[model samples]
Target: MLVYFRLLSESFRFAMNALRNNKLRTLLSLLGVTIGIFSIIAVLAAVDSLDKKITKDLSSLDKNTIYLMKMSFGPSEIPQWKREQFPNVKYDEYLYLKGAMTNTDQMGYQIFTKSESLKYGSNTVTSVNVVPVSHEFIDIQGLEFDEGRFYTESEANSAAPVVVIGNEIAKSLFEDSEPIGKKIRMYGQRFTVIGVLKKQGSGMFGNDDSSAFIPVNFVRQQFGDNNKGLVNVIIFKPEKGVDMDAYKAEISQKLRAFRGVKSGEIDNFFINVFSGFTDFIDGIISQMNVVGWIISGFSLLVGGFGIANIMFVSVKERTNLIGIQKSLGAKNRFILFQFLFEAIILSVIGGIIGLLLVWIIAMILTKALDFEFVLGMGNILLGTGLAAIIGLISGILPAISAAKLDPVEAIRTGM
Candidate 1:
């Protein structure tokens, strides 16, 4: 063990002396390693941030709840025939489905309009998404109220002109004043704010705290005709211990019966288990990570090539030095180990610098935005591993060339 440590220390001292003698060349060689490591670290940090946001967004939905919507959740596009078969589901139908299902815990309907500019006094917030939904939506989406109560079913039934504002919306408009009971105008209609929601922050879809919630029935009455009660989607949770597969089958059977679809006829609706949506999100994030690595890998390749080129130059410059070492009883293995260690050290230093750079960037991002950096230990280990592998592989030819130099001929030559 003492002998190994001495050898390692000697090799390190020799490597440092070599670097000091040719500072410019050493810096240029390390530039490649620096850039390569930087690419990997930056890409990883950004990708990790995006993944965190996506996961947080998906978590808004309960995994046990089933989502019934017009669209499918994945890359498999729904066929035109499927679209043709499934007509718009009406609000009355939602009531019937709710009544028919024995094992459902809760259900909600949602209809959304394109974002609009909202005005309170002189402050106007533009492109704020408005979701007209029933009170059940609050519970389904796991919302918390900051002030006042959500619109009740009776208020929705009566088409009562009440509104609930998100924290951001309230902040933008009323600032410090209580938003509750204040009147705000959206799309030229004045609605009284009944509640202000606690801040939920941003997600993959959009900012959850930048929208307004109103009664689904009231929204339908004002913006929709006979289709006012027609729902865009329905969400429901299953009873405890109920097998989702069996429950799904029963729901399918019931939907077919309710929609009056005959045997062999395709049903006109789409259903999705929450797991499917989460899986789709995971798939997207995985694909993004793969793409990021591929791009960063190209940079690493360039860096590796730089290292190899520099090592080749080093071999030429130190041919006489290698010859002297060989003449002094140094073995070819020792020469190879020395050169390899130098290259590995260069890469590792670059990797550490790159990691620090990425961490600073991530911290800046966290401060400028509401997101948190998610630099898992796995990413750190992976970056370090990649650097070591590149150094070893790129150093091989140079190490071998140095090891194979002819002592007499190399010492006789000026170079």
Candidate 2:
């Protein structure tokens, strides 16, 4: 064990000497490994950050939540023209489903509208996301409040002129002052702020921090119930541990009966499950992983070749040293390990530099974009392990050749 340690120490010194003596050659050799590590780790970090953001954004809502709407969230067998012709989900259907559905825990009606500006006195914030939803939306979405409270059921039903703003919107409009009970103008009407959502940062779909929520009845009243552009959706949260297939079947049966659809005809509305959407996202992430591996694999291959080339040159340079060591009764294993350790040290150093670069860039991006970019321990371990493996594979043949050299022939040739 002590001899092995001495071998490692000597190999490390030799590796440092190579770097000090041949600066440009060593740098050129290390560049491939550095770039290879950077590309792979950067791609992985970005993907992981994206996956985390998606998960965080959807964390409040249940995975079994279902959205019933005229349009499909994912691809559907229903033709686009037919889907377009389908009538929007009605408030009556929302009410009927809420009362009749047995497998549901919470259900609500919501309308996703285009961007609208809000005015507080002379201060105006433009292009803010406007969400008009029923009182039950709060429960269905599991929304957290920073101040005050969501509008009451009576308030939602009566089309009350009250609104709940996000943390960013509140800060933008009110500055240091309290936002609750302050009236803001939207759609050319005054609405009293009732609640403020907690700071949620940037989201996958949109920034929840800069959005406003109001009663769906208010939107219906303002635009009239039959507006063609308005997309009304009914959201349902299924009970935990329930059979999803049976729950979906029950919903389909109930809606089909309510809509008076006859046998053999396709259902007009689409039922989109949240879990299905997440699964689709997972598939996309998996494709990204495959692409990253393929693209970065080339870089790693070039790096491996560069290391192999350097190891061969190192063996040629150290021919006399190996001959002297063997003449002093050093074993074949010692000679082989000396060269292998040098190769590994060089590769690992390059990889460390690459990882450092990634960490710095990740920090800069996280601050610049206000999105968290993480470099987890697992990825770090994987990068280091890959570097070592590359070095070992590249060093083997050169190490073997150096170990086999006849001491007399090697010494004579070097002289």
Candidate 3:
């Protein structure tokens, strides 16, 4: 055991000597592995962070939540003109579905509107995401409060001029002073602030930090049902464990009958389920992972070649040393292991540097951006293992060739 330990120690010293002697060459050789490791781990960390954020944002909400609207969230066989001709889902339909649909848990009415600006006294916040939703949205979205409360059902129904601000919005508009009961201006009208949502970091779709919620009735009041610019959507949450297909079919039948569509004709509107949207997002994420591996794989390949190149050069330079060692009765396995250890050590060192870079960048990004970049332990282990494997593969042939050299011939060739 001690003999093997000494051999390993000797190999390590040789590896360190090579790195110390050829600083620039070592750096250049390791650069490929460094970049490859960085690329791979960085991509994985980013995707993981994004996936985690998406999960956090959607955790409270049910995956089965459905969005009923004229526009399809994903691909559709229906033509553009036909989709355009489809009427905007009306507020009445939202009510109808609430009463008519079975296996429903909760329903909400919302509108897709452009970003709006809000003003409080001299302070103004621009590009604020305006969420015009009914009172039920609070329950549907499982919204939690920071300071105040969501508007009452009567307040929403009566189109009361009230708004629920987000944490960032409250900070921007009110600073330390109380925000609830303060009046803010939007659409040339003053609205009393009612609630402030808890601070949530950036998400895959969007964040709640800069969002504001007003009653859907407020937008409906602004632009009546016939307004072309207004986009209305109906959200339905089905009861848990219900037959989704039948539930959707019932919705389709009722909506079709209401729209007066003839038999055998396609339904004009779309019933987009939230699970499908998430599934689409998952597919995109998977494709990104594949692309990252392919691109980073080239770097790893180049890195492997670099390791091999450096080992070959090392063997040539150390020919006399190997001859002397062999003449002194050193075993063939010892020479092979010496070179192998050097290759692996070099690769591992490069991988460690790459991992450090990733950690540094992740910290900076977590602070710089709303998104968090996480470098988990599993990924670290994977990177280290990959580096070691690359080293083994690159070092084998050179190690074998060196082990086979006859001492007499090698010594003569070196002289």
lDDT of 3 at 339: 88
Every model: Cα RMSD to truth: 2.8, 1.7, 1.6
Model 1 CA RMSD to the hidden true structure, in angstroms: 2.8
Tens digit of per-residue lDDT, candidate 1, span 1-415 = 7756666687668667757887787767777777777777777777777877777787767788887765566654657666644566557767888888878888887775678888999999888888877778877877788889888888877778888888898999999998888899876789999988888878777676998888878766766734533447777887778889888887778888987889997656778888887788778777877887788777788778877887788778778888898889888888888788777766766677777777888888889987888666877887788888888888899889888888888777735
For residue 263, model 1's alpha carbon misses the true position, in angstroms, by 1.7
All candidates in order of TM-score, best leading: 3, 2, 1
lDDT, each prediction:
0.78, 0.90, 0.90
> What's model 1's lDDT at 233?
74
User: lDDT of candidate 3 vs native?
Assistant: 0.90
For residue 181, model 3's alpha carbon misses the true position, in angstroms, by 2.1
Candidate 2: 10-residue stretch with minimal lDDT? 71-80
In model 1, what is the error at residue 284, expressed in angstroms?
1.5
lDDT of 3 by residue, 51-153 (tens): 8888887888798989999999898999999899999999988888888888888989999888899999999999999999999999899888998899989
In model 2, the Cα lDDT at residue 283 comes to 91
